[model samples]
Target chain A: MREIQAEEITSVVAEAIKNINFHIRPDVKAELQRALEEEASPLGRQSLQLLLENAQMAAAGVLPLCQDTGTTVIFAEVGQEVRIVGASLEEALQAGVRLATREGRLRHSIAVHPLSRGNSGDNTPAVVHYHPIPGKALKLFVMAKGGGCENASAMAMLPPLASRHGVGDYIVNIIRTNGAAACPPLIIGIGLGGNFETAPLLAKRALLRKIGEFSPDPETAKLEKVLLRRINELGIGPQGWGGSITALSVSIETAPCHIASLPVAVNVECHSHRLTEVKI
Target chain B: MSATWLKLPLEPLVLRDLKVGQWVNLSGSLYTARDAALKQIFDLEADNKQPPVDLKGQLIYFVGPTPPAPGESVGSAGPTTSRRMEHFIPALIEAGVSGIMGKGPLSQSTVKELQRKGIIYLAAAGGAGAFYGSKVRGATITAYEELGPEAIYCMHIENFPAVVAIDLEGGDLFEQGPKTYRKET
Candidate 1:
């Protein structure tokens, strides 16, 4: 088995966490550029212009893409044949995130408890999900999720009898009522067909996909297009001030589920889609 | 069209003249607070107590900014969602707040109170943190310093770009702006 030092894992996460905050993803930036060209409303166009300028400033490293540097989420895919050294995997991740939050000057946004209102101070204890893959390679996908959009995320288990249009309607309703507050032109990720917990995970994972890339499943790909149109048609627009481009893209992921359950989860990502990945 | 540069101590006349959908540049003293800080003040008020800062005629920006980098006025300071703080608007208005600054449309109750109190609601560009963070002239933690990013901060801001999202007349940009461009698919 190949052994990787825990310090290496921490430093990698440290660098990635800091950098992703400073720069918006290129795919997301390109979508914003396209939105600027296609946007119809005068105000929508102006908002897009400000976002583009913000991107330039952020690229200069003067400031990060957002202030609410948000909850740090990491998806670590570890090779089954590899062993981690120096510290436990979870401890390494926590230490890495803490180091980056302090040195990188990212905001410490994690709270200790819902009722106690204690700040973690160093932005530690990041939510981590581990997947085992074959071989001696380890990969990490990191996201700095902002509160406004994450607060808008939801999950529901629809009746298996619910039609595809019904599923579409439920998703649209979620955006119509909750989308504006989350920020827009949103990158919406929908997870369909998994069990309760799995569905939401699938949805969150869907958000990490490249913006505007359709799913391999033809039906899922078509559903993505349909939802994108239906959502943009809501006229929710950028920042919910209103316009033709309410959503930049709708990405979906699916998994097999129980025969009686048709679970769905939606994760709304704001225009400042901070995502990055690394392999080692 | 000429630009509107509003300085501190915004008079009632200026507030009245402002309408939904008009963009304005603000330069003056502002306070930054979000969920926790607002909740503290709300609880304080419920007990017939006073908050640390005098909110009278001041605008409260709903935000939790990163600590400043060296030689910079602030770190990426941008607006957070306003809806979460909607319930605190009345207490803030009662304390004589003249304006609210944040992103997204507020609920009807919040809008109604703003209209009644003639408090201006403004939207700084959401996700445009780098630009808005530069506009902050100075920032000092005023309350809840232990809360870190969620602390109440008094910020001296200049040339901060904001649109009049709601005004004294009950007109709302969030409602009107989107309707003008709605397309049936």
Candidate 2:
């Protein structure tokens, strides 16, 4: 069995947190740039330009891209043949987040209680989802969910008769109704055909797909393209000034569902789209 | 158009002069607060208790920034959603806050309140936290430090950037612009 020290995992988490704060991944950057080129609304183009500038400034100066640095969500895939040494894995991850919060100069947004409300100074005790995978290496993906777009996420279970057209209509309606509150030039993550809760998970997971990357399945890819065109047509321009580039991308993940159920989930992400990953 | 700057201890200014797209750089003493903090302030007002800060002509920033590291003045101090604070806003205006700074839409009631009180609401670019943080030169806690980032912080800013989202006439950029440009079938 391969043995990994607790300090090693802590270091990985620390670096991943720091990296996501300042530098958005390359694929994400490229997508935002592409949207800027196609944006029809002058205001939309301007908003995109500001977004690009924000990213550049954050990276060059080693500062946070958005004031809402978000709650740290960790998805870890642990290998079966590996043994954790030094300290409990959870504690090590929290320690890593604590170190990153201090060193990276990140915002501590996590509240101590949902009702009473108090900030956890270090941003520690990350939201961790662990899965045992068939591998000798551990992989972790960290997502920081800002409140603006995260508050707009929703899920609904439709009847089996809900057609692809119905699904499209539902999604478009939600985005239309939510408007700029979700932040225009948004990324929509749609999960279809899964159980209720898992549908949302699939939708969020789909967000990790490359910006503007089409699904491999022809039908799904066509849906993504059509939805992209329709949303931009809303003219919710950049910052909702009425524009052509309303949505940056739409990613969908699907799984088999019960014959009587059509579970759909929509997770909207702001232009910030902050996420990072590491394999150790 | 020439740019103008304002200092704290402000006197009432006509909202008529503020244009839809004009840029403004604000300075002087501003208080930091958001939804939770706003709610608390309103609750105190309801009980006839004095609020933590003297808000007459005071500028309240709708932000709950991240904790600054050991040596920085503040962390990405960007605006939070304005819609969430809608319920508390009219009361804040009634209580004498001259300005509110945040992003996104404001409630109709908020717009009305701004007009009635000759107040203003501004929008800072949503994601430009780093750029905005540079404008904050100093900060101090006047109340609710236990609330951490959500606490009411008295901040001194220099040349902070924002656009007039809601002027004294109840004209709101968010409502008017979107309605004009919304696509029709």
Candidate 3:
């Protein structure tokens, strides 16, 4: 068995969280560059330019990409052969996150309590998901999910017999109404099948897929293409000022489910897509 | 299209003349308030108490900026989503607010509330915080400092950019701009 120190995980997470807020993912940056060239609206072109510029400035450490640094969501894939020492996984991760929020000067955005509406101040208690994998090394998938885009996320249980068009329509309608606030062009992650809870999880996890990559499933890959075309037609454009190119990409992840259930989820991520993959 | 430069402490006539889809650069002072501060102001008004600052003739910017890095006046200061704060608009207008600047489209009911009232709405680049932060020349906590980023900040800004989203006669670029570009699919 391979043994990994909890401190090592903490250090890795600390840097990963801080790095993502400042640097645009290379794939996302390339997509934005391509979008700038293809965008039909003059206003969209301008907004895209500002977005690219913001990405550059942020990478240089002039400032963060956004004032709303957002909720920390970590998905950890632990190797079956690995054992952790010194601290609990959650404790290690939270300590690293707290350190980054302070040292990086990222915004402390999480609410202390829903009823109180008070700030959490440290931006701790990240939404973490753990999965067991077959490797000897630990993997962490981290995202600084923005509030605006998160507010745009939706989930529904369509009829088990719902057609391809029916499911697509439900996802498109959510973005049609909420896309403006989410910030565009957006990275659309869709989840299909599984139970009610897992559907949204699949969708949220789908966002970590790089822009331009499609589902491994042949049929799901086709749906991603179709959904991208339909959503862009909404004309939400960049910052909702209007134009062609509402979404940058659409990705889907699906799983087998009970025969009676058909669950769907859409996790909308904004132009400022802050995510990274780290192997330890 | 050439951009129009609008000064703060907006005049009623200027507010009426601003048209949807026009790009504008703003200079001078405005108050920054988002979800929490607006709620506080409304609550204060409900009790017939004065808000910490006089809001008359001022434009309210919906933003919650990051705390400044070393030697910076304010940290990344982009606009927040405006629709969430829609509830405070009418009362703020009644309190003499002339304009607002934020991102996203407000709901129809709120748009109707501002109809013929000469209330101008400006939409900034939503998450371009670093860009907007450069435009802020000065900032001071005007009220509710305990609220951190959501605190009301009186900012002296120069040439901050936005597009006029909704104009005096209930003309909204958000409503019209989409239809203009939406392709029949």
Candidate 4:
């Protein structure tokens, strides 16, 4: 068994939160560069240029890449052979986020209550998902997901007979209608074949994949390509100002499901696309 | 293509000349507000009370900037989705606000109201908050300090860039720009 100290987890989480906010992942940056060259609209191209500059400035520590440093969404895969010392995993992660929010000067965006509309002040209680893996190591994926893009996410439970094209159509329609609001060019994450709740979770998890990387499954990879082409053709352009590069990349993840259902969810991410992974 | 440099508290005539798809580099003073600030303004107006800041002939940016790092004028500040503020826009326009700056498209009814009032809607690059925030020369929270980042801030900006997404004549670049390039595949 591998024993990990809770302070170690806290430090890693804190560093991940702070670093991810200031830095755009290199793969996502490369995609933006490609979009800059390929975009035909003058305004769209200009938007991409500014996005690139923003990434550079953010990395230089001038400011975070986005004002909405985002709701901290963490995915942890803990091995059964690993044991945490001193504190619970959840408390450690929350403490790390709280420290990052203070040290990084990030906005306190979390509302204490959804109805009463109270501010959480420290941006604590990260939305965390945990899965048990077989190895002795623990893996963590963290994303600072902006509210604009989060609000644009959608899901549908289609009839069993709905073809792959129908799924593609639904995804395309959601982007077409809500793409601008989410901030294009977007990174699209799709979850297919899961039940209702898991479908949305899978969709969001799919976004953790590096930009431009395709699923290993051939059929799923092809679907990613097709959907990428279809979404870009929507001409929502960069920042939805209009152009040929609406989406930078499309990633899809799938799981087995009931015989009567085809549940799909689309989670849209903004161009900032701040996410990082750590293993211990 | 070419960006036009303009100063804020833009005149009605100056706003009338802006068309959808035109780039602008704005400078001068403007007020910031988001969902919470807008709601407060609406409530105060409904109660026949005046807001803390004047709305007449001013520009308002829909943004909730991150807290500034030490010695910085502002933190990464960019336009939020404008659709959420649509309901408050007509009221703002009626109060004599000449221009709105945000990201994404506004509702058709909001566009109509903007046209009726001869105001314009500009879109800054979403997710490019760091770049935009750098343009802010000064910022002071003007109202609703309790709302934290959502509070109203009077900001002095220099050469802040945006595109005229909706014009005074009601030309919506969000619709027209896409239609111009969309391939009917």
All candidates: DockQ: 0.77, 0.55, 0.75, 0.83
Residue-level error in angstroms, candidate 3, position A171 = 0.7
C-alpha lDDT values of all predictions: 0.89, 0.79, 0.89, 0.91
Candidate closest to the true structure, highest DockQ = 4
- Put down candidate 3 lDDT per residue, A1-280, tens digits, no spaces: 9988999988989899889988989998999899999998888898899888888888877578999998999999999999989998889899888888888888879897988988889898899999999979899998999998899999998889999999999999999999988989999999999998999999999998989999888999999999999999998788898889899999999988888889999999999999999999
The residue-by-residue lDDT of candidate 1 on A105-190, one tens digit each, is: 88888888978978888987799999999999999999999889998989899999898899999999899889888879999999
When summed lDDT is taken over every stretch of 10 residues in candidate 2 chain B, the lowest stretch is: B1-10
- On residues A107-191, what C-alpha lDDT tens digit does candidate 4 reach at each position? 8999989888899999987999999999899999988999999999999999988988999999999999999889899999999
Model 3 clashing residue pairs (backbone): none
Candidate 2 vs candidate 4: which has greater DockQ? 4
Error of 4 at A255 (Å): 1.3
Off by over 4 Å in 2: B1-11, B69-71
- Which candidate gets the maximum lDDT versus the true structure? 4
User: Using alpha carbons, what is the TM-score of model 3?
Assistant: 0.98
Quote model 1's iRMS. Answer: 1.4
The TM-score each candidate achieves on chain A is: 0.98, 0.95, 0.98, 0.98
Model 1: residues >4 Å from true position, as ranges? none
TM-scores of all predicted structures:
0.98, 0.93, 0.98, 0.98
Q: Please rank every candidate by TM-score, starting with the best.
A: 4, 1, 3, 2
**Across residues B12-76, which tens digit of lDDT does each residue of candidate 1 receive?**
67898887878888898889889988988999999999998898988899998988999865798
Which portions of model 3 miss their true places by more than 4 Å? none
